[model samples]
Target chain A: MNGPYVAVIGAGQATAEQERVAERVGELLAEAGAVLVSGGRGGVMLASCRGAHRRGGLTLGLLPGPDRAEGNPFLTVTVPTGMGELRNGLVARTADGVIAVGGGWGTLSEIGFAMRLGRPLIAVGSWTVEGPAREPSYPTADTAEAAVSWVLRQLG
Target chain B: MNGPYVAVIGAGQATAEQERVAERVGELLAEAGAVLVSGGRGGVMLASCRGAHRRGGLTLGLLPGPDRAEGNPFLTVTVPTGMGELRNGLVARTADGVIAVGGGWGTLSEIGFAMRLGRPLIAVGSWTVEGPAREPSYPTADTAEAAVSWVLRQLG
Candidate 1:
């Protein structure tokens, strides 16, 4: 059977804390035998892919630009969409569940799409968006372990 | 030379005012010899496509789902991406300029992508996002004519 596809959404420019969290999240997802998906650029995407790659896990990168070479070296597969920021939607859609690390506008867009598509979502030190009634849409975790565990549980 | 591609973005469920604005935007874009692009479903998308179609303008629908039949019949060409909300990125990328009539989370996502990609963008009765310094990234217009004029001017 195919492994669960879990996307880790974040910004290309991430803080040290976010990068550390993203890497740990990737390693955990890899150990759990889930395929990791990401934007395939730098920062959080690179960190996650590196962790997964070191663990010998399959990693997919949906790159925004036209050059596959631009993807993080750790990606097992790379798809360069040449669609620019639009590829954020693909990164969100191709996953069974989503874990967002520290992010920005792009990550926020992915979060919006993920919520709209009803994908199981978890956030860690990420942007918190409210519904029309001002209720938090998804749960936020404090650690990569919690984020991975929560997202996988939701997938199951 | 090919005509300019202008995307009109908004929610599938729109208010009457938004629909009116979107349709007028479509008419103006078509009259200006521009190609109209959208998510190609209902609400604002259908309204814009309907206006453009009535004006004999070429309308392109980047559908989120797999079925072209789901697209508004006003489209001259329909590309069913089967990418779900990810097609929103394509809608933003394919346009030379973007005009958001009225929106929600989805539109917010598109606005994020458009700004991230540095696409000429405008809003009309739509979401207003603030940047790091609380500055609006794009211009907002009070009417369809003003929005179209501002966006086309930006393109030039």
Candidate 2:
């Protein structure tokens, strides 16, 4: 059986805490037998791919730039989109669900696309998007374990 | 000399006023000898393509789904990305500049990508993004002519 394709979206320049969280999330996802998809660059993305790589999980990185070398070493498969920040949409689209760690404008863009496409999303120490009613649009998790659990459950 | 590649980003289902503005924007861009690009589905996208098509301007549509038939009839060329909403990043990446007519979440995602990529961007009665200092991030034009003029000027 094919594993679920889950994308981990976050900032390339992430905080130490965010990196730790993302790595744990990646490890958990990989252990669950999920195919990991990411933007395929550093910091949060790198950390997540590293975790998954060490666990012998399949990792796919959709690079924003055209050069494959820009992708992190941990990725098992890399596609250099050369589409710049636009590749974020592909990361969101290619995934069955999404887990966001620390994020910035680029990460926000992915979150927006994921929600717009009606994909299941979970955030761990990430940006919060409020709906018209000023309510949080998606569920949030306190830890990486919670996030992975929630996203996997939602996928199921 | 080749004309500039400007993307018209907006909602697939837009307000009538937005559609009118988008059509005029497309007409003005065509008159200026600029190539038009859009998501190429309906509402603002269709109106812009229609205006540009009538003026004999080249229009390219980057479709979200895999089917080319889903694109509007007015598009001169169409690429079905099968990337879903992720194709919004391609639309933003492929253009030299972007003009957003009133938008929804999907349009907002494109705007986010454009700004993140540092692509010259102008909003026409579209979403407003503020920087950390609470200042407007990009220029906004009141009219289609003004939008085309400002984006073209920014490009030059």
Top-lDDT candidate index: 2
**Model 2 over residues A84-125: C-alpha lDDT tens digits?**
777788888899999989777787788778878888998887
Report how far off residue A14 is in candidate 2 (Å). 1.6
The C-alpha lDDT values of all candidates are 0.85, 0.86
| Model 2 interface Cα RMSD in Å | 4.2
Q: Tens-digit lDDT track for model 2 on B1-156? A: 299999999888887888999999899889888899999999899999998988989999999899999999999899999977878888888899999898777887887788777889988877654322232367888899899999989888
* Model 1 / residue B104 / CA error / Å: 4.4
What DockQ does each listed candidate score?
Answer: 0.29, 0.27
Off by over 4 Å in 1: A1-3, A53-57, A64-69, A76-87, A127-136, B1-3, B53-57, B65-69, B77-85, B128-136
- Candidate 1: residue B24 Cα off by (Å): 2.4
Give the lowest summed-lDDT range of ten residues in model 2 chain A: A127-136
DockQ of 2: 0.27
- For model 2, the chain A TM-score is 0.96
